[model samples]
Target: MSRAVLWTKVVAGGLLMVVGGPAFVEYIRPSDEELRKRYNPDLQKRSAEQGERRAQEFDDYVNKLKHWSKSDKSIWYAAQEELDNKRAAIEAQRAQAKEETRTQREEMRKEMLGEK
Candidate 1:
């Protein structure tokens, strides 16, 4: 290419980068809260729903176990144990969420009071 054309191309490329870099970063970059919200907008609601469904399943299994023959007792107990583990995990998740919300509220309160 001619010198003038090459210089013009370089200038245009620089201009595009200068203008587009921030826009590109802004378009792709997400704040921590935004990322969390995008990934789990209704954490409490979803967790509660999942816990409810699992509890219902546990109840159904218990009822089935109650009427099942003695030979099947071990199988039913194993299933119940699995459900118990799931319930424990769900409870832990709920506790973690509660802790996070509590910390967030405390931070907001401190911000309002002009304290770090």
Candidate 2:
């Protein structure tokens, strides 16, 4: 080639390298997608373990509340009141059933004796 053309080409090539070097390095750098794929399973396992721990903590708190209901007087009283109400309802039903049975028995006795 001509000397002028050779020098011009060399200077142009050097200028291109200088301008694009940093961008070229960045383009060849490993991507976040590759790094993320490596750690994704470990991240999911940690997240799931944290969720299970949170669930266990919630269950423990609920169990504590249940124990407190049994031990603490106010909570015990509330629970006892509920139990008392249930017992009262059951007793009331039993009394009604007994009254009904007695009535039916009396009616049968009267029919057998021809009293009414």
| lDDT digits (tens) for residues 50-82 of candidate 1 | 978999999987776665534445866766776
TM-scores for candidates 1 onward, in order: 0.37, 0.37
lDDT of 1: 0.82
lDDT of 1 at 82: 65
Candidate 2, after superposition: displacement of residue 28 in Å? 43
| Model 2 Cα lDDT, one tens digit per residue, 19-49 | 7897799888879766556777989678667
Candidate 2 off by > 4 Å: 1-73
Error of 1 at 56 (Å): 20
Candidate 2's error at 8, in angstroms? 67
